[model samples]
Target: MNEYQPQEQLQNATLILILGILSIIGCFCYGVLGIILAIVALILAQKATKTYAQNPEMYLGYQNVKIGKILAIIGLVISVIYMCLVIWLIVTFGMEALQDQELMQQRLEEMMGQ
Candidate 1:
């Protein structure tokens, strides 16, 4: 006689996936939000990976965890790049130029030697 057991869904898999997607979208918010979200998603994914590894046959949705981790890494990289760009812009153009369109244009023109 044999019995069958249902597999359980990996914990935090869906949440990790959602957070990863949000991290990518949030990069437009000056990159800070995206970086925060991505870091959280990655941490959650790590926990989920460990859970899945403990009992591979007992859990499902490991793929979600993997995909989420990949997305989070991508988001983190993009967010860092964006943040660096923002910092560079602030340094080159000045924070006040960012607050004023005319000032921004003037700064851009000056930078371009126009």
Candidate 2:
């Protein structure tokens, strides 16, 4: 008779999920750190998913990969938007004005006519 051994879960599945969640939280860092985390999580998830696909019975944690991919995409989008906004502010107000918090607030209020 042949002995049976249980298959192990896909490697880095939990890590991928953690990175994904961190990316979302990191978005608060002007979307820079968040984007990096998201990208890493996405790459890991892809590798794990591909490996799992090749041998469906050998690994597990497909759900983590899927969720991580989604979070990475969202984080990427947010990062791009944040970068664009910062560029626009710099162009519109100049680098010096942006460096001064008071001036930046004043300019923003003026733009809003408040």
Candidate 3:
């Protein structure tokens, strides 16, 4: 008779999930924080995947890793787009214009020939 061993939860699965969620929310913060969090989650997910592949039956929570990786990818894309937009704004409108909403609006109107 063979004794059964309990399966362990994959390491970093929960952390990855939390980071994935946070990365999306962090996108509003200039996209830097979101990018950081998403990168970390992706790295951890990759590690978890390798671990799971080595012994599929020895660990659980692979689903969380998958979900986290998907979410992280989404967050990363969104964050990159947002960052690009911010950089474009800074480049199109001088930094001083960005400091003042009224100035920024005025510049936009001028550009629009309003």
Candidate 4:
């Protein structure tokens, strides 16, 4: 049976964290993928915490786990905010399009009458 190792767990957590950060940076080019990475990082961080709790004596990577968690959370929040802004912009544009159509119709009617 493989024994639990703190260093290994910490390393995994750090990798996840890095991936999450990179994902956030990539958000400009790949929005949905970035959000997925953030969520994966968050899950890995939580796993690291649980491992630490199970083996307090081998708590070598607690700091790494904490850092990973923070990065994941920040990335996730940023992604959510970006998505919300995009949705709002789309809705606003649609409304503007409808208004433009109405104005164009009114103008056409006036031109015909005159």
- Which candidate gets the maximum lDDT versus the true structure? 3
Report lDDT (CA) for all predictions: 0.92, 0.85, 0.94, 0.69
**Cα lDDT tens digits for candidate 2, 4-94:** 6688888898899889888888877877888899999989988998898898876778888888888888887887788788788789978
Residue range 1-114, candidate 4, lDDT tens digits: 978654443548568758767667756542566688878888887777787788667657677667767777777777778877767655644545435877656655775898
Candidate 1: misplaced stretches above 4 Å? 1-3
TM-score of each model, paired residue for residue: 0.93, 0.81, 0.94, 0.65
In model 2, the clashing pairs are: none
Write the candidate numbers in order of decreasing lDDT: 3, 1, 2, 4
Better candidate number, 2 or 3, judged by TM-score = 3
What 10-residue stretch in candidate 2 is worst by lDDT? Answer: 2-11
- Distance from true position, residue 75, model 1, in Å? 0.6
TM-score quality measure for candidate 1: 0.93
Across 5-41, the per-residue lDDT of candidate 3 in tens digits comes to 7999999999999999999999888899899999999
The better candidate by lDDT, 2 or 4, is: 2
Query: Which parts of model 2 are misplaced by more than 4 Å?
Result: 1-5, 99-101, 105-114
Candidate 4 ranges beyond 4 A from true positions: 1-11, 94-114
Best by TM-score: 3
